[model samples]
Target: MILTVISAWRSLLAVAGLSLTVEGLYYLIRYLKRFRERRPPQVLFFPAPVTCVRPLLLSSPGHCNCSRSHRESALSCLTRLLLSARRSLDVCVFTISSVELSSSVLAVHGRGVRVRVITDSDYMALAGSQVGAFRRAGIEVRHDQDANYMHHKFAVIDGLILITGSLNWSAQGIFGNKENVIIIKSTDVVKEFIEEFERLWNEYDPSNYSFSPKS
Candidate 1:
C-alpha cells in the first residue's frame, strides 16, 4: 500500500511539473505575439500658425537709401545666404547675371555645398544673363525644358531659410528695377518652396539639355 501511495505521489508531481512547463511556454508565446503586433510610431507636423517661426529679413530696394554699391544692394543679402549655407542651395531665378552673386555661388560650390540653378529658357539669353558664367564655374544649371516659362524667382538655403520675391539675379534687377526680396526664416515655408523647386527641377529634364534662348 505504501509503495502504491509513493508511486501515485510521484505521478502527481510529474504531472504538476509538466503543467508548469506548458504554462510558461504559453505565456512566452503570448508575450512574443503582442510585441510583434504593436503598431509603429506616427509622424506629425504642426500647423502654420503654431509652427516654428524665425527671423524675417527684408531687402526692399525702394525702402533703402544706401550707396549704389554691391555691398548696399539687395543682392548682398543673397550673397550672404550663399556664404552662410553649410549643406545645400536651390536657386530658381529668371536670370542671374551679377558677377558678385555668381562668384559667391561658385565659392560655396567649391566648398561642397550642393548648388542647383534653374532659369527661364528665354531669359537665360538676355545680354546680361550669367548662365555662361555659371556653366563655366562647373555649377549644375538648368532651365525650363518647355517654353511655358520657368519664371520662378525664389531660393531655399540650407533647408531652413527661404529667399523669394520680384527680385531677379541680374544687374538690372539689383540696380535698375524696384524689387522686394524677402528673407524668411521658417522651416515649414522653406520645405514647401523646396518641394516645388524639386518638382520643377525634375520636370525640366537636364539629361538632353542645351542653353539656346530663342531670339
Candidate 2:
C-alpha cells in the first residue's frame, strides 16, 4: 500500500511534467510561425507605399525635422545606412564641396557601387576639377541645366534609402548651417526621383561638356 500509492503519485507527476514540456514547445512553435507569417516581405520597387505611409505616420509629429544636434545624429545614421548599401548611389545635390562627404561617396564607389550625381551646371563647372576624381573612381556625373535653381538635395541609395534635406554636401552645411535632413526609407519616393532624373538625363547630352575628364 502506502509505498505503492507513493510510486503511483511520483509516476503521475513525471507524466504531467513531460506533457507540459511538450505542450510548451508546441505553443512556442506556433507563436513563431505566426510571427514569421505576419512579417512584411522586403520591397525592391521604388516608392513602396507601405514603407512611405508608415514613416509618414510616425514622422507626422515633427515631419522628420530635428534640431542641430539631432540633425548631426541623423546625418551620422544616414552615413552609416549609405555605407551599408551595396548596389547603387544616386545623388541630386545643389551644392557639394565637403571633402569628408566626397570621401564617403568615393568609398562607396570603390566598393563597386554605381554612383550617379546630378547637380546644377554652374555648380558642376565650379567643381570641375574635383568632378574628374569622382569620374576616374567610376562614378558618373550629370549636370542639370533645366531647373532655374537646381535646388534639390537628395541621395537615393540602393533604391531603398533616400536622404533629403537642407543639408548640402558642404562643410558649412554639415557643421555650421542649421540643416534638417530626413533619412526616408521609402522606395516610392526614390523611384519617382529616379524617373524624374532619367527624364533630365535624356535631355542633357554629356558630349557638350568640356569640363569633365570623361568628356
Candidate 3:
C-alpha cells in the first residue's frame, strides 16, 4: 500500500511540475507580447549642432598644386549625411539624378529606416531618375500634381538635421555646377522644414492629386 501511495505521489509531483512549467511559459509569452506592443518608436538624438558644407574650397596656397588636405566634396558630404540617418529621412528635392546619393538612400531604406521622397512629378519619369527604383524598393514617393513645379531641394534627417541649399541632389549639382549644400542641426530650422515637408507630403497625396484645370 505504501509503495502504491508513493508512486501516486511521484506521478502527482511530475504533473504539477509540468503544469507549473506550462503556466510559466504562457505568462512569459504574454509579457513579451505586451512589451512589444508597448515599446515606443526608436529615434536618433543629436545634442549639439552639426554643420557640413559642400564643394569645399581647396586649402592649397593660391589654389595651386600645393598638396594640402581638402575637405570633402558636396557629393561626399551629402552622401555621408544621408548615410548617417538612423530613424527617418525625408527628401524633398526638385530632382534626384545622383547615383551615389540615390544608392545611399536605398541603403538606409534597406536597413529599415523610414524614408519618404517628394519630387517633381515630371522629373520622376526622366531618364536616370531613381524615383522608380525607390518605388520598386517599397519606399513611399509623392510628387506635385499641379502645373507648377515642386522646386524644393532639402532633406530632414531624423527630424533633427536639415540639409538644404542650391544643391539639386544631381551629379551636375554636386560636381558640375557651382552648387552649395548646407547641413544644419538646429531644431528650429529643422522644425520649419519638417512642417513644409509634411504640408507638401499631404498636399501631394495621390488621393488629392488633380490634373483638372483650376478655376
lDDT for position 212 in model 3? 73
User: How would you order the candidates by TM-score, starting with the best?
Assistant: 3, 1, 2
Task: Give me the runs in candidate 2 sitting further than 4 Å from their true place.
Answer: 1-72, 127-129, 207-215
Residue 2 deviation, candidate 2, in Å? 52
TM-score (C-alpha, index-matched) for candidate 3: 0.65
Cα misplacement distance, residue 58 of candidate 1 (Å):
24
Better of 1 and 2 by TM-score: 1
TM-score of 2: 0.59
| Descending-lDDT candidate ranking | 3, 1, 2
Worst 10 residues of 2 by lDDT: 45-54
Better of 2 and 3 by lDDT: 3
Query: Per-residue CA lDDT of candidate 3, range 1-215, in tens?
Result: 99999999999999999999999999999999867654543222221122222222212223334343344444555666788889999999999987768888888898899999999988888998999999999999999986688999999999988888776777666656766566776566689999999999998899887677667
> Each candidate's TM vs. the true structure?
0.62, 0.59, 0.65
Candidate 1 Cα outliers beyond 4 Å, as residue runs: 1-73, 208-215
Q: Across residues 53-140, which tens digit of lDDT does each residue of candidate 1 receive?
A: 0111222223334443323333444566667778998889887886656667777787889999988988898887778877887888
* lDDT by candidate, in order shown: 0.70, 0.65, 0.78
Best by lDDT: 3
Clash counts for all predictions? 0, 5, 0
Residue pairs clashing, model 2: 46-187, 46-188, 47-187, 47-188, 48-188
